[model samples]
Structure formats: C-alpha cells, structure tokens
Target: MKSDIRVCASWREHHDRPVYTLTATCPACGGDAVNSAPAPYDPTDRYGEYRRALKRRARQ
Candidate 1:
C-alpha cells in the first residue's frame, strides 16, 4: 500500500556551533524515512531558470 510522506526538521543545542536538519518519513511504516530536501539551493545564485520560476511564483 502507498503511504503518506512526512517531513521534519530538528536541531541540537548546548553548544556554540550552528546546526540544521531536515527529514522525510512515511507514517504508515514507522521506520520508513528519507531526506528529500535539496542541498541548499541558493535563490540568489540561481540567476537563470529556477530563479525565474521562483520570481513568477512570488508574483502570484
């Protein structure tokens, strides 16, 4: 059977360093999970195609 996807973000404190997290999961199966986010796509650097797509979205 198909399962719905879940996404989560988490972080740890008690330190001076900065940290970030992203996660994806399938709730139908407790252990089924994945990381579905891109590796930090900077909107400012993507000056051609994706940027136009983003700008079009902003106008809407």
Candidate 2:
C-alpha cells in the first residue's frame, strides 16, 4: 500500500545550538502534527534534500 504524504512547517535554532522542529497540517481536516529533533539528527531524510524541499515550499 502507498503511504500518505503530509506537508509541514519547520524551523531550526541556529544560535548557540541547533535544534530542528517540524509541524504538519492535516490535508484532510486542517489539524496539526509536530516533531522535534536534537542536534545531529538524522542527516538522511531529517536533514537531507527532502527537508530542504519542505523548507523551500514553506517559504513560497
């Protein structure tokens, strides 16, 4: 089966320390979901091109 994809709003703290947060809006009902990661989070999907794509989309 195919999994659903959710678009999210995300941010990172880049001052003294760097932390990442991602929050998604439900496409069906407009509800919100969130996730957070400490420094050195997964560099694959968490910090990789996919995350960059999300951030880029959010800016537009």
The global C-alpha lDDT for each of the candidates, from Candidate 1 onward, is 0.43, 0.43
Question: What's the true lDDT of residue 18 in model 2?
Answer: 27
Local accuracy of candidate 2 as per-residue lDDT tens digits, 1-60? 222433322222213332222335534334453433324545565458877899999999
Clashes of each: 0, 0
Q: Supply candidate 1's per-residue lDDT for 35.
A: 52
Question: Candidate 2 versus the native: TM-score?
Answer: 0.26
For every candidate, C-alpha RMSD to the true structure in Å: 11.9, 14.4
> What does candidate 1's lDDT look like per residue over 21-59, in tens digits?
233533333333445344565566846687789999999
TM-score of each: 0.23, 0.26
Which 10-residue window of candidate 2 scores lowest in summed lDDT?
A: 6-15
The lowest-lDDT stretch of 10 consecutive residues in candidate 1 is 6-15
CA error at residue 38 for candidate 2, angstroms = 5.0
